[model samples]
Target chain A: MAMVLYELCGIDEELRFSPYCWRVRYALAHKGLTAETRPWYFTDKEALAFSGSDKVPVLVDGDQAIADSYEILRYLDRSYPEAPLLGDGMAESRARFFKHYAERSLAPAMLRTIIMDLLNAIHPKDRDYFRETREKRFGRALEEFHSPAKGLAQLDAALEPLRGQLKESDFIDGAAPAAADYLVFGSFMWARVVSSADLVSNADPVYGWLERMLDLHDGLGRSAMRVTDVEGAYR
Target chain B: MAMVLYELCGIDEELRFSPYCWRVRYALAHKGLTAETRPWYFTDKEALAFSGSDKVPVLVDGDQAIADSYEILRYLDRSYPEAPLLGDGMAESRARFFKHYAERSLAPAMLRTIIMDLLNAIHPKDRDYFRETREKRFGRALEEFHSPAKGLAQLDAALEPLRGQLKESDFIDGAAPAAADYLVFGSFMWARVVSSADLVSNADPVYGWLERMLDLHDGLGRSAMRVTDVEGAYR
Candidate 1:
C-alpha cells in the first residue's frame, strides 16, 4: 500500500513550511510510517480537490483520502495502532486542547512575527493568492500585521502555559513526544523553516525543548531546508 | 477514615469563591467521595498552618494532608483508585496541561474581569490584606484594574480555545467531566459565586457548557451560595 502526503512547499519545493503539514509529518514519524511527499503550492488547489479540502496536508493512505492534519493523524491512529500517538486513557481530548491553543493563540502571534518571511518563502505563483487571501482574512496589509517586536511579546505570553508545562516535564505529552507535543511543535516548525527570528531566548526552557524536538525521529526537523540556514538571515 | 476539607469562604461563611478550592471540591464529587467542609476565611491563616501552606483547600484524608488542588486530585486517584478523575493510561500529562492553562491564561484573564467582585465577596477583615497583596502584585490599585469592559473583551477572546472545544464535546475531557474540565470549571465557579457579570452570552457554546457544568455532580455548582442571588446585580 502506497502512502502519499500532499504538503505545502515553497518556490524551492524542498522548503516545506506549512505548520499543519509539519504536524502530520511528525505524526507519521511517530507512528513509524513513511509517506511519499507530494509537494504542493498555495495556488495548487486542484491537487487537493480530490480530498474535499482546499488545503495542503491532505494524506492518502491506500484507498482513503484524508484532508485536515488532525483528521489525518486520527485516521493514521485508527489505521496503525502500534505506537499510539494520542497516548492511553482518552488523552485525545487533551491533545485537542493543545490544537485549539496552538491555532487560536500561538499561530496568530507567530504569523504576526513571520508573515513577511513566510511570504518570501512561498511559491512564486502563491505570492498573490497568499497575500490576497491572508489580507482579506486579516482585513489589512501584511506589512501592518508584521511587527516582530510586538509579535514576539505576544508569542511569549501565549506560550506561558507551555513554558510552565515544560518546566515540569520534558515534553508537552510527557516522558516521550506524543500528539500534544506535535500539535504545538508545528508553530515553531513554521518559524524555524521560514525565518531567522529568535522565537525563544536561549535562557528559556522553550529553547531547550525546541532543540530536543528538532532532534526527534532521526533529526527530521533538524534536517529541514531552512531559509536562514541557506541564505544566512536573508529575512 | 474521616476526610475534612478546609475551604476559603467569604464573610458569609456559605460563600466560597476560591477557584483553587473549587477545583478540589469538584474533584471530590467526581470521585464519589465526601469530606466535612470547614469554611475558612482569608484572615484565618493560622488554621491552615498544619498543611505547611497558607492556602485554602487543604484536604486532610485519614492521617495525610494534601495542599494544592492539582496535588489533591492526584492524591484522590492514588488513594481512592475508584472513579479515577485523571482518567486511565498517560492522561496525567493532559490533565497537567489544563492545570497550566487554568493557572496561567484562564485565571489571569478571568481575574481581571472579577477581581472587584472577589474583593467585595471576601471576609471584611481580609479586605485590607487582599487589597495590599493584590495591589503589590499588580503594581497598581484595584480601581485601575477593575475595568469590566476591557477585562470582558480579553476574557471572551481568551476563551476562544475552550469555546471551540465545547462546540464538539459536552465537556473539556470529553463526554464525562474529568480533571481537565474541573481545572477550568474553577475559574467560572469563582465568577459564579462572587459576581453576576454575565461571563458568557447564552448564544455562545461556552455558556451552554457552563450551565451543564453548574448542573454536574447533582447540582453541586448550582447549589453553591452566590452573592448575586442575595443582592441582584449590585456589582
Candidate 2:
C-alpha cells in the first residue's frame, strides 16, 4: 500500500523554493510515491491543530507524523531503498556531508537573506501572519530579520571553502549526481525559483555550477501545489 | 574480516566530549566492532586535517570520510546490521522515531546546556582553548554561556514533551533498548561522565529513568568506551 503524506504548503513563501523541501519533493518524485500537499495560510489555526505543529512541510504518512526535514528524508530513504539516495560507498559519505551542510549551514543563511526583504514582497495581510508564526518559532519579532547584512556576510564567508572546491570539479564530491549534487541542485533551484538571485551571485565556479545544475532538471522548480481554497470552500 | 575504521580520540580538554562522538561509540559497541582510537589534542593539527574538518569522533573506514553524527550512525547501521539497531517493523519505526528525536531535538538543547555549563566549570588556564575552539563552531564567547539559565530553561522546555512518555515506559520507545535509547543514552551518559547531576536535574520518572538506563550495560556509560586512550597515547 502506498503511504499518504500531507504537506502544509504556502506558509513558507520560499519553502517551495526551499532546498529542504525540494530534497523531499525530488526524492518522492524519484521514488514514484504520491503525496497530498495542502496549501496553508499561517494565520489559520485549523492547520496547526491538524498538523500538530505550525511548521510548514509537516508530513503525515498513515499514523506517522514527522516535523523535522532530515528525519522525513531518512524515513523515505529507508522505506524505499531501490533508487537509493546514498548511492554506493564513497558516494554515500558525500551525500550525507552535503545534506548536513545544506540543513545546518546553508538554510540558516538563506533564511536571513529572505527575511531581510520579506515585507517588500509579501502581500500586506500575510505579513502579520508570517511575523506571528516566525516569532513563535524564533522568539522575536520580524524586525530582527530586518538587518540581514551580518547573516549574508557570514553565509558568503562560509561559501569560501566550497567555492575553492568548485574551481576543479563541477560537483562537490565527484562526477555525476551524488548526495551533494542533490543539495546543490535543490538549493540553487529553489533560490532561482523564489527569485533569490543574491544567493548565487557571479563567482567563478559556484555561479557557473548553479547554471549547470538547473539544466539537469530542465530549469523548473521542484514542487507542485497540493491544496487550494476558493469561494469559502476548502478543496 | 572486520572493517578497518580510522578513528580520532582523546586529549581530555580537546574536542571537549561531543554527543555526536558518543553516538558512534555506542553504535560501534552495539555492533561489536573494535576501532583504533588515535588521541589528538588541539595542538595536533595533523590528525584534524585528515578528518576534513576540525571535528573528532570522526571515522575513516577505507576511502570514506563521514562527518555528521546521524550519517555516521546510519553508516554503522548499514555496514554492521548484525546486532541490528532497527529490529523489526514496529520496533524499527519506534527506534527510528526516538533516535531521530535524540539526534534532532534533544541533542541541540542538551548541547547548549553542556557547552554552557562546561564553560563555567573548567579551569581558567584551559578556558582560552575551550572558548576558542567552541567559538569557531558556535560563533560566540564562552561568556555568552556564563548564563546557563536560558540554556537550561530551553532544555527543560524541550524535554517537557518526553515527560509523559518516560513516566510510562522505561525506554523512550517501549520495553526494550533500541536506537533511540542509544541516542538519548549517549547524551545523558556524556553528562554523567563529565559533570554529573549538573545539566540534568532529578525529578521522579526522568531521574529514575536515567539511573535505570545507566544500569543497562552493567552501569558503565556505554559498552566500555572500546577505543580508550591511556596516558596521552593513541591506542
> What ranges in model 2 sit over 4 Å off?
A1-24, A32-112, A123-141, A149-192, A195-216, A221-235, B1-25, B32-81, B85-191, B200-215, B222-235
**How high is the TM-score of chain B in model 2?**
0.69
lDDT of 2 by residue, A1-235 (tens): 4454444334343234445666666566656676766544445556657657655556677777766555666676677776555453323322444554455556556666666344433334566776777878777776776446866664674455466556646655444433455654665544444444376678556787766655554443423321121122122
Which candidate ranks first by lDDT, i.e. highest?
1
State candidate 2's TM-score.
0.44
lDDT for residue A115 in candidate 2, whole number 0-100: 67
Steric collisions counted per model: 0, 1
Q: Candidate 1 overall Cα lDDT vs. reference?
A: 0.87
Q: Can you give the lDDT of residue A58 in candidate 1?
A: 92
The candidate scoring highest on TM-score is 1
DockQ of each: 0.64, 0.03
lDDT of 2 at B104: 49
Candidate 1 C-alpha lDDT tens digits along B1-235: 7699999988587888999999999999988889999998777889989989888789999889999898999899998898778865458887898888888877787788889888888888899999999999999999898878877776776788888889888998888888899998998899889987787999999999999999999999999999866553355
Tell me chain A's TM-score in each of the predictions: 0.96, 0.68
